[model samples]
Target: MPTTSTGSKSNPARHDMSVILVTGSYDHEIRFWEAWSGICSRTIARTGESGQVNRLAISNDKRFLGAAIHKKIHIYDIGSASSDPILVLDKHTNNVTSIAFNSEGQWLASGSEDSTIRIWDLRSPGNIVHRTYENGAPVNDVIVHPNQGELISCDQAGSIKQWELTDNLCSHELTPAGDVPIRSISLASDGSCLVAGNNKGQCYVWKVNDESTSLPRFQAVTRFLAHNKYLTRCLLSPDAKYLATCSADTTVKIWSISPGYDFKQEKILVGHQRWVWDCAFSADSAYLVTASSDHTARLWEMASGETVRQYNGHHKAAVCCALHDGAS
Candidate 1:
């Protein structure tokens, strides 16, 4: 455990529904921020510089923080007295690219450079991986479906796999021609659409058949090109109303979607001086946080595309983050 590495003292007077915002960077440190005040409430030191934080995920109950680094995942008990990680989960032969949890927080799923996805039982003992799936290509991201029964994974080979946990089988697979390594993936809240962005900055969207129980189908919805630059990340707002994307072009843009899921560019957010790596919307989708190569995490007001507060602390590029508003 380490002392608060950067800012204000740890304040315990926040409301029960205080939003938790955690950002990790090339600095090898994870800092927790009070999103409203721009104060860093807690900082967890990452001693070994195996790699910068590639991604982060928070448990549903807000009891744990998961940080994905090179070949390893660190689980920090944010609710506990110590700032040190409570557990270390590792096994990947290369970088662990993405980390996420089931809606119930009963399982944690990781995607890795080793081309595998593993599900760990958080409540279990040593070596908690309860199930594993092999894709044979470096996995860039893994996202648990809102249904909580399927894991959607995209990999370097540009393959999309829907692993059905309840049935213990792969329910569907998509292998795009000239597969160009999909880098980011996002699923709509209603399980209505799925989107994946490739290294070429091309985004592919599909309509999902949520009612299907076996051999589900993803009909091609639409494909659009985000010019500017290569894609870094694409995220759908929690309410499923908008799609936000980050790119090497150094901009974060929002897209408006119709009731039928037709997407159109709504606005562009510009402030970061370098490549924008990731962005996540607040619980109400009224605020947005973006990580950038410019070494900052910015909070933005979505409506006016104005910067609300700039969280400045990371010594290096801020690459990824996790946010929870603590509301059901």
Candidate 2:
């Protein structure tokens, strides 16, 4: 027998009820937001002297959150009440700028101003740090190869280096120009393309070939000037349809990824009053989250170029963000 009700309200937010969004900034705190609402559901303190979260990464299983901080990577349980980290792995001497987990959650990689790239075996008893590879300059960005056992790192001295995890050495290096520091690096969804942005506001593109071999080759596909000011981050949508870039010019630009890595400018997102530091795409790539120096993080609808929600709890600039869509 069914109980009849006069009326029932529809729950539109149920689809993203379990989605997680963690925003970090210079305020020394990481705030987790409700997916559909602009409300901060949880806030955790994470910082040391001269250290705020420069980057954030979530494990593939969505069970752990990793924050890249000065000289260490703090691992926290996503569902825990305690603000204390479950693990603190320290090996870096300078501030950690980037951290990411492998697709299988077995390895964690980090790059830092310490001028080193390291991989940690998460399955080990202490999550032992592996062989340290020197980049000769402060590494600004790190990208894990989709092939599982490789890492591509870019440094402040304009070197794109590929490290072979099997041989524990650098197999190849790509230098577009001498001494132009690269700010960010991103890989296309199918692993066919690699793109990097530099402090000079130039973007470089390469078609990844022979990746299945021991020596992967990156052939330069295209190079273009992107922004008037420094580029902060370049990201490819998970769906492979768009490449999004944030810059010191205070804008996020979306570009279409056409054949042969030819990019066509699709839209320009404008709202932030200051530098745009970071951005993350929703699972469907229909929406984007942008962190800006204006002390806010915004959710934007891709089609209309309009902000749908503004997250406004950070005391200072929002520098980094990580979004996990549970329904995807």
106-153 per-residue lDDT for model 2 (tens digits): 779999999999888777777588668888899999988888778899
- The reply for model 2, stretches above 4 Å from the true place, is 1-17, 46-50, 212-216, 326-328
Candidate 1 C-alpha lDDT tens digits along 121-209: 98887858888898889999999998898999999888989998887777788866367888899998878889888888788888897
Question: What C-alpha lDDT values do all the predictions have?
Answer: 0.84, 0.86
For model 1, the superposed segments whose C-alpha errors exceed 4 Å read 1-17, 211-216
Superposing all C-alpha atoms, what RMSD in Å does each candidate have to the true structure?
Answer: 4.2, 4.4
Q: Best by lDDT, which number? A: 2
Model 2 local distance difference test score? 0.86
TM-score of 2: 0.92
